[model samples]
Target: MTATSDGTPKVAIILGTRPEIIKCAPLIKACDRRGVDCLLIHTGQHYSEDLDQVFFDQLELPTPDYNLEVGSRSHGEQTGRMLEGIENLLEAHTPDIVLVQGDTNSVLAGALAGAKSNIDVGHVEAGLRSFDREMPEETNRVVTDHVSDYLFAPTEETKRYLERESVPGEIVVTGNTIVDSLYEYRDLAAEKSDVLNELNVAEDDFYLLTAHRAENVDTRDSFDRLLEGVSRFAAQTDREVVYPIHPRAQSRLDEFGLAVPEEIRTIEPLDFLDFLRLESAAALVFTDSGGVQEETCILGTPCVTLRYSTERPETAYVGANCLAGLDPDDIVEAGTMMLGKCADWDVPFGDGRAAERILDVLAVGAEPDAAEVPT
Candidate 1:
């Protein structure tokens, strides 16, 4: 890895999704503390200014050095555009390492472009696989991990996944950065956010809902099923299903001419802190969001994943989450079952120091050396 004038490695952190921004926040702050030369690049995968810019402002992250603004497109078009844009930026900036997180088209393109540029790529939250080749993110994570030079696995389980696949990169089991963000921002949310008051809901009285996975949202039938489930559950239980609708999901709903039932309260996307407060206080949550799976686990809140499969099996294994695809009956059943269970459980993520450990690996050129967990 090439070092800058002051000897610290130059890292270009790339992310395109709102969840990616939240996950990368701790690492960005860590770089600031170490005086490492870092550049944040937003791929503009989620183009809504409210969703994208609000996170940067809320989390106090430096504005992205570059935003491809490649907005949503077919997988081929999006990846191709990102490949071109990221390649240009990497060549011009000449960063020592390109860091990307999670399974997104942006992550895949960034890793590919960086490796092609002969710059080592560090993939945070790497080695996750749902074993379902049909899922776009499964392919993204698989491709990204294979090409990356530094594979920062969130858990030993994911490390095993990479090992089973025989990936070439050095695997360092740094706990999920989501745990760090949750711990840091949960308190901050309580201090700065009045989300609950604005929504007119008290702690533990409502079920926080989020559903924006392409599989569930893009498919007309699946999207309808999710709404039906939420509506049914809310009508039966007399509890509000607080849904902070994603822009993409809303667009799909409009296209399908589907309406969220009066029982399911819909609102705009919440900033990172506000969302954290909402998640922490919810009696249970229903969503297909991967980050939420990890966050709810750390918060000791129950979650009912609205997808067929999940990359984060650790949450299910710890009994903090239940998977109930797009089937309305199944969704209601899983939500009811989870709500009936206890909230307190062992958090399998980390001690909120993942960012520090990640920087430790980068400091030594991502060579596996020492840690509480390394797989």
Candidate 2:
């Protein structure tokens, strides 16, 4: 493992997607203060400079020391490429421990590479389970959690899930890092952006829509149903639906000859700050994202999840989120209900000091006993 001039251990932070970058930012800064040499590595899974470069600048995260340039590809192809690239980087850098966050393929690849190299792997935002075998992300989470030496769960529920599964690691309940990052960046965005003024969005004038799941986008029927539902809903209501079109979703929209309705404003994927401003000022949020569910819950903004199930069910448990599958009618009904609902909901996620708790656990240097593998 690489050592500092005075022989301190080096910590390598691995990130690839936009979410990973944001979630890892606070921890990276924390490591910096402790005199630990931090090396940031980007797997380049989502390699858009516009979507990525601005986040690093906004979040004040250090630019990656290594970029693998793995970019967008088939699931197997991307994972294979990242695994090989990460293994090579581990050989070269030899960090004391490799840190990966969330349930991304990049995280699984990093963990597998670290385990194969006999280096310690620390997983942040770990022990989350959707219990749905159909979703690839669920598989990734399970694999990464099993391989990881440290499992940093975001809630007691997540920790309990790990305990039931007999996971061989120290599962610490550190709360959600996204909440910490969200509150920090939200304050900054409110001060810097005149987003509310520019958009002419009052506290509850419009609704935000974000849908880019593979299950929803892979089929023409599902995509059409979503568009039709939004179109019908917008026609019935006076409010506008602002959709920040994902690149993959945009391509599908064009290929399917689907027009973005006049009432639906299709904009590019927003940076963290702009997104926070939009979500905060919206009357309601409709998404298929787990992160968005938690974010909207913390903001006390009602949300309609466009998927059948969510990894973050705490939002629903707290009466803040509604699961409105891909059916257009259900989507509209859920959105309408959220719009009229009172904004007094409890934050199921803990108070936003998850990063500090996670670092505290890591600092203790408590390693789990290695378990024997069943043949």
Candidate 3:
């Protein structure tokens, strides 16, 4: 690996979705602190101003160096476009290392491009498995982990998954960077966001819902069941459910001609600060998002996941979340179970220095901080 003219490592950070931006914010900032020559590349998988630009503004990240606007498309086409665009950038810029976060198609493309170019690839939040091959994200993450030169697993359990696969990468148990992002921004969100007032909701008086995965929202049966179940739970509790609906999920609702219940309040998607504020204050959260599972757990908020399985089972293992598969009865039961339980469960993610540790390994091949590594 070669260093830049300044004798510092050069890193190309590739991301496309909201979760990736939020999770990678810390690493981006860490590069600045460490004087690493960093380049931000966006694959434009999520190209909307609402889904994409707002996150960069609210998170205080610099504008991306390049935006390959490969917007919505079939899975194969999207991944293929990303691969072409990322490979061209890799050849021209020739960074020493490529870093990708989570299990998005952009991540898969970044890893493939970096490996094909003979540049080291570092996979952050690696070694997650839902064990169900039906999910597209499962395939993306599995392939990325194998191609990566550095696998930064978020927990011992996640690291174990990599070991079991015998992936030819150096595996280090660096806790998830989402923890770092949350710890860094939670106080900022609380101070700067008045989303509760803006939405006319009170703390601990509303439920939050976010469902956008294809398996959960694309099918009529699955999507209908999810909305009905969460609506029923909200009605029984006499609390309104706030949904900052993702564009894809909203389009599905329109296509399927589904009517949202009166108890559910649908709103435009929020920026990170506002969403963090709502997540911190909501009575309970319902979602099919993996990042939200980790966030809600870290915030001590109860989550009823709207999926049959999750890659982040650590949240469920610690009693911070429950899988409510797509059944109205099951969803309501899961809500009741979580509502009855206290929100004092121990956070199992990390101590919030994951980005620093990941950069340590990538920049200088240092050992992970022993104190912060989750057992």
Kindly list the per-residue Cα lDDT of model 2 for residues 66-182, writing each as its tens digit: 899899998899999999999999999888788899998899999999999988888888888888889999999999999888888887788888999888877887777787788
lDDT for every model?
0.88, 0.82, 0.91
Worst 10 residues of 1 by lDDT: 366-375
Per-candidate TM-scores read 0.95, 0.93, 0.97
Off by over 4 Å in 2: 1-7, 364-375
Cα displacement (Å) at residue 202, model 3: 0.5
What is the clash tally of candidate 3? 0
Candidate 3 local lDDT, 1-375, one digit each (tens): 677666767899999988999999999988877677888999999988555787999888999999999999999999999999999999999899999999999999999999999999999999999999999999999999999999999998999999999999999988889998999899999999999999999999999999999998898889999999999999999999999998899999999999998999999999899999999999999999999999999998999999989999999999999999999999999999998468878878788888888887765433334254565
The best candidate in terms of lDDT: 3
Better of 1 and 2 by lDDT: 1
RMSD of 3: 1.8
